[model samples]
Target: MRWVALTAVAPVAWGANYYVTHEFLPPDSPFYGAALRALPAGLVLLGLCRQRPRGAWWWRSAVLGLLNVSVFFVLVYAASQLLPTSIASTVMAVSPLAMMLIAWTLVAERPGIAHLAGAAIGLGGVCLTLLTGTAGVSMPGVLASVAAMLVSSFGHILTKRWNAGTDVLASTAWQLTAGGLFLLLVAAAVEGPPPSLSTSALLAFGYVTLVATALAFAAWFIGLRYLPAGTVGLVGLLNPVTGVLLGTAVAGEVLTVQQLCGLALVLAGVVLGQPTRAGRRGGSRTPLQPAPDKSAAREFSTRNPL
Candidate 1:
């Protein structure tokens, strides 16, 4: 489906994020990268969308951006400075579990036993992956990463809840713009003057802005419009998986058998968390019902398959 394809593109773009941050950007400049990546992209997207949000949509967009992008990026980049990318990513792997919990509490959307079990298994795998590291994990780094993921998860759940009546493009543009401004403020206060931007750093910034943030989020909204929320959440597991593989293949990072097992468990969890024919009965369904024409459905489905 169109949604599926669009959603699928997100993880692929995100997979390259670690490398772009670690290798391309200068050390201790993650915040700088975050600022550059978000602000311009936000502006571009906002210009393109050119639609104003009404009423509570503006407040919701700001809140979502603060949680999902500004705060999340700060914690993640800071944690990455102190922790290995793999470890940071492993910590992020718990996002689905967090989103599931939030959905249950706020929306009364109970996760089935399979979803819970899979989340538990996936979390365990994440723990194993973290434990396998010899470089002693910093407590602050662990806490920061976990906090980042939790906030990001909350943002995701909020987005799902709000997207029902909102204009996706307008919501996204506002959120990104808000997040960008917050990041810029942080960068100005905490990081002071930007470092001498190198060519690689510039490229990384461009990639993050154009590809990771803008394109990926656009794709995500498209996918969310068609898929079940849980399915969309579960598909996020691919993010770290692709990150790990790319880290190994491109960055020459080592992967032990335990880590491989962890990957397998994560994949298993994703599969188990997916909606079966029965499980899709209850949940927040997208209102933009597919057209009756099979060709229209097929085209839309190709871009956004559930």
Candidate 2:
């Protein structure tokens, strides 16, 4: 339950992202917003941890940073502009299947019936909860959304497969910093000068940086470190659920009967998909082995063995 809650925190905070992005943050500035949300939080965490990338992790963090954070955020923002939240979110709902397949292939972790069914139920619930009428979806938006799912799923599996030697906090901070730095350059080139943020925008950025980006990523990484990737992927369903519920509660949107039913299905799916001590069967995984790089290899072997 504690692990489940930790995984849930990421999507819950992200669910609120819909509200904050729409209501408070500066419009037409996804890059800047993403950079702001990530870079500072990463810096603060890195400062506290005072942990540098160990050996091969220098390259590994850059790769993970780009896929998990940089490109993922950029594509999400792009999809939002091109498609409705329902469309973008429902597309993303397929990530659990992707994560499962990747996990199976990479680590030979077989999916249990409960998790498989839960994924289907949760995905259906998400569709029911979010999609209604037709969306003005763009081709680019569809591509971006699909790409986001693929990239993030692969990145997550890699996070599980080739984990870092550092503590969860420092590992997460390193990736965020790398991703954030990349975004700073991209946002400058593509978006040009940063837009002036409103008071509300500033406040929204603060919440996203500290609570959403910093704390949320910490919980997410912890989940990835400890829980099965499929379970973590299922928890992502909570993002749209959170957004839909928040819309009803905070944005004066009407909640339909279908939405309520969908939420229930999502809950059921989550419950079914949860990882338990009884459920966790030992699976084949590649162990982290040491190499010539004493710092990185030793850290990977001793600290982050699969």
Candidate 3:
């Protein structure tokens, strides 16, 4: 419960990322924007953690970093450029479904029918809330967003696989540093000259680095450690909800009746996906890993028992 609550913080920050990027950040240099968001936060975190990846983890850290942070951020930012935040986010709503399949395959979790139903409902609700009846979407942007969701799903599973009993902070720091460096080189090569920042842009970048990348990723790893992959993915639908609410509250946009109803459905979907205790007599807990599984624990003991 505590980890779930902590993980929920990431969505709101991610919601703010869309708004800040669209409203304030440079549109043309997504690579640079991505690099800026990642590298600084990573360096700061690495400084604090003071732990280095050893042996196989060095490559594993790099792979996870590229999949989760560097490449994912660039793709997401590019999608935000071409698609409405709503459209991009709605596309991301499918993550729960994707994670369900991946988690079942990887971790051997058998979430009941309710979990699948919840994913479908949450995805539909996201569509209803954010679609806005737009007929045309940029094909490239849509593809990028969907690809982003897919890669991130895999990344989440990988995180769970490698995470086991590792220090969330140190692991996150390693991935960030590796991904940050990779993106920095790409940003330098393709992005050309860096854009000058106004005060607001600097502040927004600061917020992105601190809240969105640093704090959010930390909480995300914590959530992955505690919750099942599918549940964490389901909770991700809240990102779109936060984006929608932020639009209405901060951007002065008004919500329609359909959108309100859709929000309700999204909430219901999240609840439905959660594990519920069966009857008291011979009561059995539904599939949920409140902590690492046995294999994961063994891996931790063998790899790093310090």
Least accurate stretch of 10 residues (summed lDDT) in model 3?
A: 278-287
127-176 in candidate 1: lDDT tens per residue? Answer: 77778846677889889888988888778776766665445666677888
* Residue pairs with backbone overlap in model 3: none
For candidate 1, the lDDT comes to 0.72
**lDDT, candidates in the order shown:** 0.72, 0.76, 0.78
Per-residue error (Å), model 2, residue 23: 1.6
Q: Write the residue-wise lDDT of candidate 3 on 195-247 in tens digits.
A: 78889989999999999999999888788776777667778888878777776
Off by over 4 Å in 3: 135-137, 252-254, 277-306
How high is the lDDT of residue 73 in model 2?
A: 80
Cα lDDT for residue 104, model 3?
A: 73
Candidate that would win on TM-score: 3
Rank candidates, lDDT, best first: 3, 2, 1
TM-scores, all models, native as reference: 0.85, 0.87, 0.88
Cα shift from native, residue 19, model 1 (Å): 2.1
What's the count of clashing pairs in each model shown? 14, 0, 0
Off by over 4 Å in 2: 80-90, 134-143, 281-297, 300-306
Name the better of 2 and 3 by TM-score: 3
